[model samples]
Every structure is written in structure tokens, then in C-alpha cells.
Target: MVSLTERTRQGWLPLFVLAVGMSMIIIDATIVNVAVPAILADLRLSATDVEWINSIYSLMFAALLIPLGRTGDVRGRRRMFVLGLVVFLAASALAAASVSGPMLIGARVIQGVGAAMVVPMTLATINAVYTGSRRVIAFAVWGSVIGGMAAVGPLLGGWLVTDHGWRWAFWVNLPIGLLVLAGATRVPETRDPSAGGHDVPGVLLSTVGTSSLVFSLIESQRYGWGGSSPVPYAFALAVLALTGLVLVERSRARRGRPVMLDLSLFSISSFRYGGAAATVVALGEFGMILVLPLFLQTAIGFTAFQTGLIIASLAAGAFLSGGIVPRLAKLMPARRIVQLGLLCEAAGAAAIGLVVSPGLGPWTFVPWLALYGLGVGFASAQLTSVMLAQVPSRQSGQASGLQSTMRQVGAAIGVAALGGVLVTGLGGAMERHLPDRPDLARAVRDSAGAAIAGIREPATRAAAVEASAEATRRVSLVTGAVLLAGVGAALLLPDTGGRRREEE
Candidate 1:
């Protein structure tokens, strides 16, 4: 066994490397948001297709999260992390070089697969390496990476897309991936030594369930909700698969083979509530990544750099949260801090909804965005810490993986669901205004509410802009309200009181 002191000394290095490695995933998801317009022009993609560019990645990443997490437990998390990096790097290269839309989306799916592998393993490794107070501190650090990468992704993407090219967004990951791979060596491989073999049945059922569920959600947008699509059927199938998965997992557990996930973990109220809250919060946060930049550049006319900077302010809030949450975790109940954080998000979203003035510069959003970040920082960081705290050492890897899977699933669903709201709303409005002018109407439609907002006729343009602004405002408010529901979830969560929830 690695001595505690020796492990402590070497552990954080790997954690840092893991943090950096996982950042590529977060950054890639957000960075591509602002660049979609550029990508469309370069690759001649439709609006629906462009949305897929973002959705596909999150979809795959979310779908594979649980299975990958389980695999990390049976295999070696360090080994998985390394493999993920290599795959991601290769995918990034392909994405950077892709000359067509299909090829690009395919590459992004590959990248997502790699991300799914890396994200959970990193968290699992952290759980394996640290213990006690140090573990709390480590999670705070880990939480920072989550917020930090997301916060900065837009900024870096803006710079890369605006200055060099959109391809640079993926290209940059190559060097970062290499650096992480090199740094990973210093950190020892950590796995559940007794975690027998892989649970293939559980993996299959979960994958089928998650993939079908996500596919159904995404499919609903293009086809009308009623009969235009088979999304409902897909969703039904997914639910059935999940039911099947539960039965299989129970049988596996009864048979004494290690199940991919211990169902009993859900019996811990803290973990269940924390995981739910994390999922909802993730939906709001990642959903915004897809929605907000489009509002900024397309509707507000801000440059990509400006959009990035504005988004970075939100990151600044997240960074602020990261720094303080660990200390906050010490004094107050994490549940309370989490509630406070959710409220912050709600308030920020409300402010953004009520006060997005057209001529107003990016600074107009500073306070609210920062506040939103603060909410995410406080609530989100604690969720991870509290969730993992419930599980024993042997199950940490699985728990960590579950948390990651939930987060990614939330993100993917958010991107698709919330994004659908924007697209559908915008399309409806444009059709109402451009009756008889099908070509112009279609162009307006193709721009996805943005084209209508760009109308140059002063009266028409102002009206369209205001309408577009209202759409964005509504999205902000609705998403914020969704976050507030998470606050309520936090309230129901078992209070650890004083120190860790695990102790109580």
C-alpha cells in the first residue's frame, strides 16, 4: 500500500493533471458555442446541424459516463484517463482538419467518447487518493476545475475563433492533452483492487437507456411533439431499458458479482438529493452555454471576444465561489450554502431577464452574471463534495463516476432541451412575421430567430430586436426558475450540520 504521506505528496499532482485533462472537455463544450456561426459559414451547416455539433458531444459524453465510471473501478482509473486523453487528442486533430459537416460531427462524437472516459476517472481518482479534511479540500480544488474550465472556455474560444480560426479551438487541446498525459505519470494508478470484473450487462442496459433517452429528447425538436417524430417511443424504450437495468443490477448484486453501481447508494438522502440538484443545476448551466452566446453575438451584436469577456465575468464569479466554498463548507451546513447558491443563480437569472438593455454594453451583465456564478460555485461545488462523502472508500470510484455521469447527462439534456426552447420559439416568431415571403422567411427561419433580429429596416429591426431580446430574456428567467427549483431540492437534502454530512 502507498504510505499516507507519500500518497499525499504525489496525489495532488495527478489530481491537477486530471483537472487539466478534464478541462478540455468542459472548454470544448462551451467554446464551440460562439463559433457555430463561423462553423456554419465555413462548413455550410444548417441551424439544426450546428446545434448537433454541440449536442452530439454532450450526448455521447453523458451517455457513456456511468459505464465508463464503472469501468474505471474494475480497470484502472489512471489507465482510463490516459487512454481518454489519447483518444480525445486524436479526435481533436480530426475535428480541426475536418472539411465537411458530417466528418466534423463524427469527430466531435469521438471527442465526447474520450471526454466521457476522462471525466469520471478523474473524479474517481480524486476520491481514491484523498481522505478526511484533505479530501474536502481536494474536492473544492476539483470543483474549481469544473467551474474554472467552464468559465474560461468561452473566453479562450472567443480569442481563438476571432483571431486564428475556429479550428484552433480544437487544436489547442492537442498540446494540453499531451501535457496532461506527461503529468499523469507522476500520479499512481488507483482502482478498486477487489472490484472483480466488469459488469457487461449493467453497462449495456445503462448505455441503451441513456442513449435512447437522450436521443428521444433531441429528436423531439425537429419533429412536431405529437406525431411528427418517434421521440416518444424512443423515450419509452429508454425507460424500459432503465427498468431492465435495475433488475439486472439487483441480480448481479445478489449473485455476489460486483455491480456497476450499488443501488443502495441512492438510499442515502444526501447523495440522492445532491445528485438530483447537480443534474438540474447542470441543465441550467450547460444549457446557457448554448443559448447565451447566440443571444450575445446574433441578437446583441457583440463580437466573439466581447461575448467571451462577458461570459468570463460569470467564470470570475465561479472562481470566487471555488475559493470560498471549502471554507464555507467548514462553518455552515453544506445544504444551506447550496440553497444560498441556488438562490444566487435564480436572482442572477432574474436580473438578466429583466435588465438586458440593447445599447447596454457587456458590463450591464456583470453583477448578475457574477452573482449567477457565485450560486453555481456555492451549490455545485458542495454537491460534489457531499455526494462523494456518502460512499465508503471502496465505492468512491463508482460514486465519483455517478456524480460525473449525472452532471454530464444534465448538461447534455440542458443543451438539447433548453436549446430547443430557443430554436422553436425563434422559428415560430419569424414565421408569423414573414408570411408570403417564404424565401426571406426561410432565411429568417434558417437564422433561427437571429436573422429576424438582424432586419435593417429601423422600425422592423427595432421590433425584431426587441422580440429577440425578449426571447433571450425569457430563456434566462425560465432557466433561472428551473435553478430555483434546485434550491428547493437543496432544502430537502439532509443537513450534515457543522462538519461533513457523512459524519452526521
Candidate 2:
């Protein structure tokens, strides 16, 4: 058997294969959103069941990333990559054939595990195979795919659900998976020669810490943060687990055993700040993605298709910026470019907040969203290159895993924190504006869609719409503020002039 390294000297084929596999994972993250209503109706799923179906994949995926990434480093990246593809492909098939909600959720959990294995390897492999300028280009393409696919997911899901039904969303992964598998054969196998025996305690601690933390964040929106809700308990458990992980990893290092996370990586200023900026970027990006559709549909009366099309403008901007940033890197430092992107995002979000209203047209928000997307494209395209540049090639797998873990945690928090803001704002608006009818106001506060549908009086409907519009406006502003914070974090990154040579 020809080795993957010897077969493809230029490395484009392997890169393309990695991109395709990654696209599957990134697309799956948001593709299910547009199909949820259809799935619920077809499968007779309760609201809780539907929520779990949506949340469980991410929960499992985030939890297993560090452990699996370490496994790939200890074993072989290519081998784990192939195994991940197999698991993902099988789970996709099971999900497509699912007869009940529980079956689908189960399949999704397995799918998340596969995705966890596949994601870190893509970047680690690129870090290994590409050198200098080519390495910079490789990471640019990787980042572009991530940003572009996330934006495309909802549009693609809407089209698939509208035309071929919800099952095709999962089914579409089959051919792509096969193509990736075939190409995987040509990808070089790489691993850490110095990697020691796995620390089982380290794995358990990291898994529990991340999963519990993510679960608490995700569930806090549904189950209020106070009282007997599991949010506080889960959060406390997360803190305990994470602290334990730190102690255990330090012990493992002292004992000369492999640990899941290299706490030492945090010592690098670029890695530390770059990871922080990535998290903040994700918080703004994912929060906006979640809240925009709600505002468009509930406050502005756009259909799902119409909402998706408007959202596509964001993707369009991201694609345009993604293409431009690699060249821009030639002219400016990566840190400055990231700061510029965050500025665009902040400005765009602020613009949206100012302009969003019940009377606003659907097309009115497109330009602002596009600007925000452009920011995402620029930041995402270079941040990975900026951060991973600091890590030695041998440690690329663990670094990539940590990078991904930060982004996931950011996303989960973005949704929960920004989502909570929207909910609270809406309730507050309704309470303040609808003082005459407390019951109706409470109903509207509880469910925006139900409020829109149930309120028959024109005055009441108008008040509810205004309340929703206000809530959305506030959320947009908050999202902008979050991105602005990312700007400050981006400044901490060493001003490496966008030269791949300099990064190396």
C-alpha cells in the first residue's frame, strides 16, 4: 500500500477530502433547525423531544472532542479520521431511517462522536501536510468552509425540507462520506511519537467538565437559572469537574503520562488570546444567527424561506470576505485584520439594532447582515492560522481540539446568554406596554409566536409586535457589544504581518 504522503506530494486532494468531511460536520450543526417543524409533525415528537434532538448532538460532540483528539494524536490522525467517517456515515443512515424521535436522537449522539473525531484531525492534518505559505492558505480554506457552511446550512436545510423532505438532509451525507473515505486513503498518517499512555481519569474529568458545562448553558434558557432547576447544580458540577481535570492533568504531566489537554499551551500569548477571540467571535456570530430568524419570522412576518434567503446575504458576505482575507493578509498583520473584521461585525450589528422594527421590510436588514457576515469571514479565515501558528506540528492535534472546544463552548453560551436576553427583553416589553391586560401580556411574554397567533385585537397585536421588535433590537445591540469585546481580545494577538513565513 502506497503511503498517503508519497501518493499526493502537492496535498490538494487530501485537503479537498478533509474540507468535504468538515463541511458535513459543520453543516449538520445547523441543518436540522429548518427541518425541526417537519420532523415534529411527521414523528409526533413533543417539544422536549425536539429540543433534545437539536441539543444532544452538540452536547456529545463538544464533550468528546478533547478525548478523541488526544486519541488521534496518540494513535494516528489518518486512521482516526477514517474511523470517524465510518461512524458518521453509519449514524447519518440511521438518522435518516429513524422511525421515532428517540431513534433519531440516538443516531445524532453517535454522529456527534464521529464529528468530534473528524474535526480536530482536519486542521492537525493541514498543519502537518502544508508548510509555510501553503499552510496559511490551507487554514484559510478550512476557516472559509467553516464560516460558509454554517451560513449555508439553514438555506440548504430549508430547500431540502421544502422539496425532498427532512430525511434528505441526513441522507445527503452518504455520498459525501464515501468520497471522503476514498480520499482518506491518500492522506498521510501522522501521530506523536512521544505520546504516552492515555490517562483514563483525565478523559473522564474533561468529558464530565465540558459536557456538564455545555449542558448547563444550553438548558439554562429552557430551565430558568434559579430555584430547583438543574442549571445551578449542573454548573457547579462543571466547575468541579474542570477543576479536577486541571489537578489530574498536572499530576499526569508529573508522572510522564499523556494528558488530554496540554495546560502549557495557555502560556503562549497568541494561543491564549486567539482562543479567547475565537470564543467571543462565536458568541456574537451564533447568537446573531439564532436571534435573527426569530425576529424576522415573529416580528417581521417573514416565512421560513424568506428568512433563509435574507440570511444567505450574510453567507454571501462571508464568502466574499473569506476570499479577500487571504490576499489581505499579504498587506496587513493578521491581528489587525481580525480587529477590522470585528469592527465590521460590531458596526453591522449596531446598524441592525437601530433599524430593526415591526414595520421594517425583510430586505432592509440584508446589508447589515452582510456586513456582519463579512466580519465573520475575515475573523474566522485568519484566527485559526494566527493561533495554531504558535503550536509545534507535533502538538497540532491537541491545539486544534482546544481551539474547536473554545468555539463550541462559545456557541453554547452565545445561544443561552443572548437568548436569555431576548426572552427577558420581550417579557419586560410586554409587561411595560401591556399593563391593562396582565393575562394577555403574560401569554405574549411566554411565547412570541403564540402571542402573535392568539392575540385577536389589533391594539393588542400591535403592542405585542412592538415588544418583540424591541427585544430583537436589544439582542442585536448586545451581539454587537460582544463582538466589540472580541476586538479588544484580537488586539492581544502578536502582530504577525500576514506572512505565512512570519507565522512559521
Of candidate 2, the 10-residue stretch with the lowest lDDT total is 495-504
Native-referenced Cα lDDT, model 1? 0.78
Models, CA RMSD each: 2.4, 3.1
* Each prediction's whole-model lDDT (CA): 0.78, 0.79
Tell me the RMSD of model 2 versus the true structure. 3.1
For all predicted structures, in order, the TM-scores are 0.93, 0.89
lDDT (Cα, tens digit) per residue for candidate 2, span 356-408 = 88899868989998998898888886888788777777678888898988887
Instruction: Please write out the lDDT profile of model 1 over residues 1-504, one tens digit for every residue.
Output: 455577788757777887888778777776788777668667866667766787788778877777787777777888888898999999999999999999999999999899888988887877778777777777788779878888888789899989988898889888878888999887677778767777788878887887787777776766655765788888888999999989999888888987886787898788899888988988888777677787787777777788888888887898889878767766888788888899999899889888865566778988999999898889876877777666777777777778787887788788778777776666665556544455655564456555644468775655555556666777787788889888877888887542333432
Who wins the TM-score comparison? 1
Looking at model 2, the pairs that clash are none
